[model samples]
Target chain A: MSDIDVAMARALLLARRGPSSDPNPRVGCVVLDDAGEVVGEGWHEGAGSPHAEVAALARAGTAAHGGTAVVTLEPCGHTGRTGPCTAALITAGVARVVFARPDANPDAAGGAQRLRAAGIHVSQIEDLGLRTEADALVARWQQAQDLGRPVVTWKFASTLDGRGAAADGTSQWITGAPARQDVHDLRADADTILVGTGTAWTDDPRLTVRDRRGADRPQQPRRAVMGLRGLRPGSVLERTGATVLDTRCPHEALRRLWALGSRHVWLEGGATLAAVFWQARLVDHVVAYVAPAFLGLGAPAVADLGIGSIDAIARLRLDDVTRLGDDLRLMLTPTPDPTEGA
Target chain B: MSDIDVAMARALLLARRGPSSDPNPRVGCVVLDDAGEVVGEGWHEGAGSPHAEVAALARAGTAAHGGTAVVTLEPCGHTGRTGPCTAALITAGVARVVFARPDANPDAAGGAQRLRAAGIHVSQIEDLGLRTEADALVARWQQAQDLGRPVVTWKFASTLDGRGAAADGTSQWITGAPARQDVHDLRADADTILVGTGTAWTDDPRLTVRDRRGADRPQQPRRAVMGLRGLRPGSVLERTGATVLDTRCPHEALRRLWALGSRHVWLEGGATLAAVFWQARLVDHVVAYVAPAFLGLGAPAVADLGIGSIDAIARLRLDDVTRLGDDLRLMLTPTPDPTEGA
Candidate 1:
């Protein structure tokens, strides 16, 4: 790998330390002295915080003079609550700058051009080897920005035979404790947790991220229920201050969620809701926890998505397979169908 | 490891080379000289062929005198088509004999006692570390002999959602080529392939073992269908000379299969039959090939097995998980429930 790739990987790791629920993209910066030694590093904490370049420059002090700054995202040229990061780097006397991903937001883009205009050397991390890691640092934010909607991740826990609940609807537990903890982790990473009104009425899930001891985490994702039917009057969702989308169409619900500043949506379904999202191709990622048990009769994990024959089956590429206790967690993404129009 | 353990492991490997469909146990023998160097190796060919000990003895000739004989199974004292292996070993003048597993068949057991009575130094492979490996060598045959029924292995191919077919009943294939080939390999290892009459009438599957190139293997397992209803007229089963076990009970079907000399029975089902076997606790082993695809509506891989709640779920311990092309092959065994009586 090139020197820039190594610095960008470190920058990505630092970026992950930032709050994922923030509307703004996470960014990390590393400032190097003239001798190619890292002098300072900083990551954006959340919205209204100092930009990564400004934070790094403050830590670097005089070492920023004639030095290089490596960042996970391009230094912003447009000012928001804080001044433009390009001006900060220029004022700090940094001679060279390297970035992993270019800022795609129209309002904050063109930092690379501004740096070049100021006669400072600017380069992007162009190594193909570091592209995936670099892109993943801001993949969900980038996707949400590109599509004008929250990136949806559909999650479910089911038996080996794909039953989500038993015949009598008693599904208190399907996956083991470890898998459930992993799901809580997933919930904590998202900006919103969504379910259908049917789930809200039938299950009345608290929809709160919790620790192993069952204590609710401080920064819980915003809970929301979609569909025209209203939740039960005494439902847990009503007590938990969850938003009611009041729309049967998945597109409208996602649009409202995007408007509500939800960049990533965790979709917990009751089969029928999942089918609608899948049928409309709204699901971006799938996380399935399959327990090594057989419930020969129960609610199927997913309802019909208009598939009638084998040729119409929804194919997914298995990205990762992990064993969490006795349950197998499968991470998958839909493979693009050549027969379907974009 | 002990020298005897190494020799017995080699003997087990040689034993596996014999035809699994043979009524007699596959036994291998290795004759070691006084210097602990192998002088000869032999495995029983089939029923009419010489026993493993006699074959090794014939190859050892004069070298057998004052040497050691390592066999996978105890040398038989009574003979059917050949002279007693004990008599042959005594004539060969072997000083010591080590066997991995004792013969359990009533007609052929007591070989160890006979060898001791003849004043030969007899030793059994008693190493705890090699017990599982040794037991697996003859597990199916021994189980059949002990239970008076064939050892049943239930095999099925399904989508990740536990679907066996599409909504339109069009399921030409669920798993990929590699998983299908693995199923054929499983069929080749079993003595019989049993399905329900409903499957025979609906699918009319050609239950024959075949190679990768679509050529029928010379040694195919016996195909049989069990149910009260008769098979459809002029089905593939009729053309393939499959037997009809006209009984709805899983126990009766297994009993008839045992009477027909089936030691290992591979149960390939179309949902209902699998549920019956599982409900009866007749499924000793399970092999599930899960394709990384979703069929939202289809025939489930298994029907209702009388479980109404999560507490009644049939749990299994995953023994092995393997990736076959794009599909996953899971090998599992039933976990004993403490609440249920044996």
Candidate 2:
């Protein structure tokens, strides 16, 4: 617990950053109590949960002995449906755990080396998993194991002089409508929310995820479409609940859609598939929605990402930095996936 | 030339908006003498000289009697490359003509009813062509002829509160290297310069247009690629002075791209082909280059043309702003075409 109670249990592992399965990252867990308060807080909401340290040690029962649990990765120790958050922090008697970064999944990198070989008193916090809304849940699985595919995070909603619409794509009431229904809870946990084909032919978008419960109670996600084809004859990507992908070879169409399962992908545009998956390192995490308004030129704050200078870029690495409504959310992690283009 | 000098030539033809085909919409044309300063001052720049009213009635050749030409758009009466600018402002006797906007086409819209059926003396200047920066070259060719394509006027430079790089992709010295070598003179009249596949897998780009005395230059627009099949092999779209389209239907993949000719197209991107041509409205125009600094949230400020709200926004309209070096440019015009989908 100390490192500020696992940095407030890694900011409650980002209430599943918009939802889950999203390249599966966002994670938060609390627990505290040596009178420091915050007895239990959970997170890791989708993919069938109980995890986030078994929902904060089942709400920290037995007052979790000497208190302290925190967690934000580095606490899995093998398992699929449950068990082993370092053996549920040694049967919840938890003398000390702390944790923050360190979890590039060799299957939970050995949960703090098996809680220091059972001696407990763990403690780790290396980069307290930076806070861009609690590190877009582990930079969306560390950019899906460094780009095998399924890990694109682009959340933009600008204005503080970043212009998104005023030159004439009208830009709908700039960022109001209650922050565009909070990006549909950030695309309901994104497994797919893409946007292109000229933003669905000038915004004919049904990218789903409603909130005021209007448009027949939306909140869908999985609406994609990248482009090259014309798309009009029956439109909305031929309707019937979407999934269009066609920006030809978009990282081999997202690695054959992550081997036909798709863990988490949400690129959603502003500069063409966010510069085609941040120049195909297949973007790992980024949730921007900056909206204020000036439009000095009118359009372009991010067009063309085929980068021609700075020797072409892609070593990113940051990790987290959050803010939401007036929007902001930088969570990067590149460095280790140039494998020369694949 | 008299109905108040054709109303100040329709207020100097609403100012001088375009054969925006490439930089040359310089239309000027003064001609005041009775107490006013210069007897004349023409301007136009390219494609058939003598435009700005036969270069201000051939520099007011015969100071041409009663003087007063003003002008901007309404002076042509027909003839392919020369002659008839309302018959050289009725043989340069230029008594009065004013002007500013009235050339919407149909063979140069009757030039103020043929300069009031040659009775000369015309007036005008109404919305002064909506007022300013050379009427965006007649709203960028009336938005590429009411949206058949060629309109995306975006310019980009970044930093002033808008950030184009920093959060890891670094953004190569921000906007130096002499404003990135003045965007190759804005890609030499740009007829094409797009990017996707996350800018060819995180910067393996080669959109070309460099120059220092033509450094391997092939000047004058041409270099596109939106979904460029799956290149992992020697990346950079396999190289060789590119021209790939890899169809998926960007409105019939742009009719096999006018059989390899060219007419103007720069959809440029990062947010999935700017959200697939900003939702297939095909971007028509938006040239932003803010520059001052902020990179805050992850990456991408203009990456999704796959539009979402404001009913698929394609009609932007602004036209021309300015600044340049520290960054600004602006100049949009799409108001039509773009029915819907991404």
lDDT of 1 by residue, B165-196 (tens): 99999887888899999999988888899999
By lDDT, the best candidate is: 1
User: In model 2, which runs have C-alpha deviations exceeding 4 angstroms?
Assistant: A1-156, A160-182, A190-283, A290-292, A295-342, B1-73, B76-156, B159-172, B175-287, B290-342
Model 1 stretches with alpha carbons more than 4 Å out = A1-10, A31-41, A58-68, A78-83, A104-109, A124-132, A338-342, B1-10, B21-23, B32-41, B47-49, B58-67, B77-83, B102-110, B124-133, B338-342
Q: Write the per-residue lDDT of candidate 1 for residues A128-235, one digit (tens) a residue.
A: 655567678788888888878898899989888889999999997888899999999889888899999999888879999999898998778889999989878878
Highest TM-score: which candidate? 1
Kindly give the stretch of ten consecutive residues in candidate 1 chain B with the minimal lDDT sum: B75-84
lDDT at residue A178 of model 1 (Cα atoms): 97
Per-model TM-score on C-alpha atoms: 0.90, 0.29
Q: Please, what are the lDDT tens digits per residue for candidate 2 over residues B117-144?
A: 7677786555543334345545544555
Candidate 2 C-alpha lDDT tens digits along A213-284 = 646333355666766764555666556546666655578667766765566777777565676666665666
- Model 2 has a DockQ score of 0.05
Which lDDT value does model 1 have at A120?
Answer: 93
